[model samples]
Target chain A: MNNIEIKDLSKKYAGFLLDKISFNVPSGAIVGLIGENGAGKTTTIKSILNIINSEGTVKILGKDSKAHEKEIKKDLGVVLDDSFLSAYLTPKHINSVMKDFYQTWDENKYNDLLKQFGLPTDKLVKDFSSGMKMKLKIATAISHNPKILILDEPTSGLDPVVRSEILDIFRKYIEEDETRSILLSTHITTDLEHISDYIVFIDKGKIVLNVPTLELLEEYGVAKCTKEEFSKINEKDYVSYKKGKYQYEVLINDKNSFKKKYGITSIDKPSIDDIMLFYIKGER
Target chain B: MIKGLLKKDLYNLASYKTSLIIIVIFCGMAIIGTDAIYWGSVVIGIIVGMISLSTFSYDEMAKSNRYILTLPVTRKEIVLEKYILAIGATILGSLLGFVLTLLIGNIMNYVRPDNVIDINIDTLLATTIGGLFGVSLIQAIQIPSIFKWGAEKGRIQMFIVLFVLALIGSGVGFLIKESGLSVDIAKLESVLKNFGLFLLILLSFIIYFISYKISYKIYKNKEE
Candidate 1:
């Protein structure tokens, strides 16, 4: 069974729209939701969590998210961009508060995570730096040993060192097989590149690509050639193109066929950022 | 879970314990500032009223509802917890205010034999009834507004509520002076004594249940 299944989901805002989003994150798989700003990644996450009014079905662990929201949320952990912890509250207060709310809350796990993150139990959340606040959110998200972890821009606005530490924590969280899954949304594609097994690229509220990360990299290649040589290639073969004064870079959907048509020069791998930029700019 | 939520709110409030202590001390000063018994009672009532208003505002400013909703608890639990906290704070603050006022009244009585003042059961009952009514009004307006409109918008509604209450008070005063019912205080006291306990209990439950229902509906329909 899929860990999460979002079918025909759509939500409309005044200036933003999330249109007919459908995807599934199978148990134990890490799915990266790649999108540019205002591309509806956060809206999708909010809809899946039933945080906003939406028109469609969102199922987690084979249960309807809205009908069984409380039960579903009990085994799910969410880390939003903003810190929901009040400024006046300390980690010590959070521990006591969580103890009451979560039946599966482990005090030892919470304390260990806090110590590992170097968060002071006595310090108020208002005094925390942005990175520290992100760490705190991660600590709380993992402390319950949840079945699924949903993160929105968990690594944005953090130093490289802190970002790597958070990535490492995510790696550790998904070590268990078939029991843990993650749906991570980020504009920073580099962070998702290293850990994501699947990538779903969304542009302008519509999905452009949804496939295994390795397959995506294997099937598509960014080819660089002179403008004269670029004309020799079929326009239908490429998803997008970035032209320069002396050279033309084309994103080929079928890497193998393109290599066969022309002698393989140097086919560059497309990063998540490259895919997002090219797709949004209608370059490929 | 309710206990945890309640404790969290209390702890959050505790961070400003120093400020709260200062306010309590100010209440103590106001209780002792006036020489007349009626003036002292008015001061105590105003102080308690201010505390109730501040508590509601602080809870909204802190976004306590947003934080609580993220937990595994239900929206119903969140609404019930706020009601519990409001009522609990009112009781605790009223008791503290009563004790401080009684102490000041006794001290003044000792200093001047001719102006001796004593707090009887009637005084205590009146103070309790007035405090409960004030807290109920605050919660009735604050809970629904905050739950529906959020903290920023709710602040405006809070001011409107205060304004409406002031108008009502003045209107009642004008009616008393115009109709020559100034002597009705004795009759009012007699009626209060006869049905005061029952009325107070009924009003408290009615206010809490209504506030709870309104807040719950707002929360259920609220979109992040």
Candidate 2:
């Protein structure tokens, strides 16, 4: 079964609206939720968790999020961008509190995670730096041995070394349980680019694209050519294109086909960042 | 889940150094200050009520509710937990107030013997229950308001509710005066005094239940 499934989910506000967006994370893989600021990544995640009101349904482990939210949440671990408990609380206090919140609460795992993350057990959360706070949140999310881990910007302020370490932890977590799945949302595309098995791109509250990361890395490429060469290429061959100072960097869906048809040697594999930039900022 | 939520709130309240300081000062005043000694349990009740409200403010400051709702707890459970925390704090505060009343009353009577501020057990019981009842009523509306609109916006709602209440009070007074009804203050006081304690307790629970229902609805409908 798909571990996490969001189907036709939509949320509306005065000025913003998350259109009917759908995606799925099959068991045993990490799916990167990529989007720009205000692109409804948080909104979509909130909707799926029933944190906000929405029209469509989100199913986790084949149960509706709203109907069986409490039950569904038992197997779900969440790490939000903002810290969850009072800033006056320490990790020690949280351990005591979470001892009751989760039936799967593991004191040893929690303490070990705290030690691993280098988080001070005595200091108040308010006193911790942003990176430390994020790490603390990640530590809490994983200590419960959840079947699904949903993180919203889990590594925003984290330094590169710490970010990679956290990613490795995620890798190890999934390796530990093949049925475990991860839906991590972040703007730091490089972090996900290395580990994400599938990438879902969201723009203006809509799912612009959803494809396997392998396909994105292997099949997608940028075709850089002169204005004369750009005019010769068929409009249907490229998804979007950016007009550079001298050359036109066109984003194509089938790099192999474009290479075979046009014999373009300038084609290079596109990063998630490049795809996001081309999709959001480049013209069709 | 509710237990977990309350535990977290208790930790938050305990960590608030200023709240701890305020509690100490209030209890200290209850010991030494003559007027404070008379108020006894009421002083401690007010302090506890203020400290309990601080938990809500802390939740907002840290945006903890978003994280909390994602846990295996429902929004109704969250509202219920806040109510329980408020009641728990009130009970703790009442105990402190009651003990302080007895201790200070004895000390003052011992030190002065004559012209002393004496608080009897009956007065302490009456005032402590009365003060807690009022505090609970305010929290009934206040907690729900804070849940619906955040701590800051909820304060404005409280002001509006108070303003509406004042308007109704003035209208009632004006109508009475215009109707040539004689204002019998002592008779009215005697009527209220004669009111059954059981009835008052019943009303308090009813009000609290209604408030819980409202808070549950508001919190349940609230967006993360």
Candidate 3:
């Protein structure tokens, strides 16, 4: 079952356009939406939540985002980077307030997360560090046992140890329910390297690639060779190429087949970051 | 959903700790100022209006307003909560005014009988009702503009609203002087009696409801 299905998602700003984007996060899959800043990642997430007036149909848990928006959202947890808690509210105040928002608010889980995150129940959120605030937001998101989680740069500004812990929490969150899914958007491709089952590369509002992470790892490779050697390889075989002062690195969709045909030996598996850089900035 | 939104706003409002100071200021003014008993409801009304509008500033203070939309509530519910908060603030303000008037009047009676001011219950009722009407009128104009432009931008609109209302008032006063039956307290009371207090309450609510509808419409289409 698909937990989220966004079809023909389009939003226009004064100078930028989020062209018709279509993708889905199947049940139990982590789909990472990777795009540079101003690449419409936030806009796409906002459109999915109906937070912005966008032209598209977003289906969450098989329900329309607009007509069934309320019901659909009851089970959807969303966290945004800038939308941290108010400075005056303590964790205790947040608990009471969230109790009103969710019918199945789990007090025990919230307290446990607060304890684990090293957050004081009585202290104001404003007094917490940026990393602490991020943890608090994630804690709130998971406390309700959401069926779907949509996070925009949820791990930004956190230390490596904390980011890893948050990722572990996400892993446990998904493990709790097989049908639960997550759509996480971030430029930190390393975070998605291990967790994301699918990678959707978006650049300039258009989806450049939507493939399983395993498929991306298995099918894509970067061939580092001399400029003369790179020139010999068919332009049709490589998706993109980057020219350094010393060497040329060409990216190919199918390394195994290209190797057999071109006899090029220096082929390494392309990381999600490499693929993103090549797609967004590499030469034709 | 409206309850949840209101709970969040109410919590935020209380945490601000500014409401207490505003109330204290109102009390201070009431105790020392002349005709303070009569102006209690008006002061309270303004306090409520300011607090209710302050919620928007808080919501916009951070991108928390955007965060809130990700919750299960509709944009309509969020807007509805603001109206509810406004109503709550109005009641709180008006009651504070009324209670202080009585307490201050009674205190003056005991401490200095020579300085005691007798505040009529009928006048109090009329002012409370009038205060609610005045606040309702201000909100009806202010809320829609706030929804269209945020709190910062709406500040300019707020001044413009006050200016327009003043202009309208002076224009009406000129019209009355030009072709008038004698306008006095007796005439006003007679007109009020004929128009009916219940009718005024109903009219004010009707205008408030329209304002809420307009605010919701503006907020629904708004992009964060």
Candidate 4:
């Protein structure tokens, strides 16, 4: 059974829209949602959690998300891009508050995370730095022992050191079982590049690609060649191109065959960001 | 859930303890000056009612509703907890205010016999009932507004509610005085003796229950 499935999901805003986007994250897989600003990554996460109204069928753990929202949320963890802590509340206060709302909230796990993140339990959340606040949110989300973790841009605006620390936490979380899954939405494709089993690219309110990370990288190649030889290659086989004074960079499918046929000097592997940029620009 | 929510509210309000102390002192002064302890108690009760409304507004402004809803709790539980907390705060505040008023009254009586003021049980009961009635009505209207339109718009709705209540109170007072009926203190005492407790308690519970249902519907359909 799928861990999460979204079908024909659509939400329309005045300036931004999430078109009929659909995808599935099978049980035990880490899926990365990659897009630029205003690409509806957060919108999709909100719709799945039923935080926003949308027209679609969203199923989590084989149940409709809306009909079983409270029930489903019991086993699901969510961390939005921004902090939701009340200015006056401290980490200790939040723990007591969570005890009342969640039946499975683990106080030991929560306190352990606070120590791990170096967050002061007695200090008010408003005084915390942005990175600290994000750590607090992550602590809260994981304390309930959720089966699925849905994070939207959790690494945005944080320093490299903090981002790596958070990624380490994600890695630990997924090590529990192949049945546990994570749907992480972020602009920092490098973070996903190391850990993601599947990458889903969304742009202009629509999904461009949803495939295994390794297969996509194996099939697509970024080659550097002279302008004359670059033009000689078939345009249909290439996804995008960049020009230079002495050389040309082009993204083509079947890297091995293209390398042998054209005898290119270098065939570089495309980063997740590079793949997203080329697909978005070339599609338009 | 209700206990947790109440503790959170109380924790947040801990920093305002000095303000609460000042308000109690002011109420004591009002009672000593006016020599009408019951009316002074009524003033203190109204102040506490306003504090409850302000707390609800603060929660809205902080987007606490959205955060709480995302947790493993039902919207119905959230709405029910707010009603519980509103009533709990009102009761606790009114009890403290009453005790403070009595202490001040006794102190003044010992200092100056000529200005001594005595508060009867009936007076205390009347003030408590009136305070609860006002609190329940305020929450009944304010909760729905916050759920429907959010904090910024809810503040406007709060002012509108207060204005409407003021107008209704004035209109009722005018009719009572203009009717030329026997407006004796004995009749008022008899009315209180017969049904005031039942009426006040019933009104408070009914208003609270209705508000809970309305708030639940609004919250369930709310777009975060």
- Candidate 3 structure quality by residue, lDDT tens digits, B59-98: 7887677888888888888888888888778777777777
TM-score of chain B of 4: 0.81
**lDDT values, one for every candidate:** 0.78, 0.86, 0.85, 0.82
> Which structure among the candidates has the greatest DockQ?
2
Candidate rank order under DockQ? 2, 3, 4, 1
lDDT of 1 by residue, A131-219 (tens): 98888888887788899999989999999999999999988898954579999999888987789999998877888799898887678
Which residue runs of candidate 3 sit more than 4 Å off their true CA positions? B18-26, B33-36, B168-189, B193-199
TM-scores of all candidate predictions against the true structure = 0.90, 0.94, 0.94, 0.90
| Candidate 4: residue A159 lDDT (0-100) | 98
Rank ordering of all candidates by lDDT, starting from the highest: 2, 3, 4, 1
lDDT of 1 by residue, B7-35 (tens): 77677677667877787677667655654
- Report the C-alpha displacement of residue A192, candidate 3, in angstroms: 0.7
Instruction: State the lDDT of candidate 4 residue by residue for A1-284, as single tens digits.
Output: 68999999999999877989999998888899999988989889988987789999999999999889888988898887753636688999999988876799999999999998999999998898999999999999989888999998999999999999999998989896668899999999999877888998889899988999887778887888886887788876677887767887788767888877778859898888788877776431
Instruction: TM-score chain B for all models.
Output: 0.75, 0.85, 0.85, 0.81
On a 0 to 100 scale, what is the lDDT of residue A255 in model 3?
Answer: 92
Better of 1 and 3 by lDDT: 3
List the DockQ of the predictions in order: 0.49, 0.84, 0.68, 0.51
Q: Please list the Cα RMSD from the true structure of every candidate, rounded to 1 decimal place.
A: 3.4, 2.2, 2.3, 3.3
As for candidate 2, its clashing pairs are none
lDDT of 4 by residue, B157-192 (tens): 877978998999999989988997667899888887
Task: Show the colliding residue pairs in model 3.
Answer: none
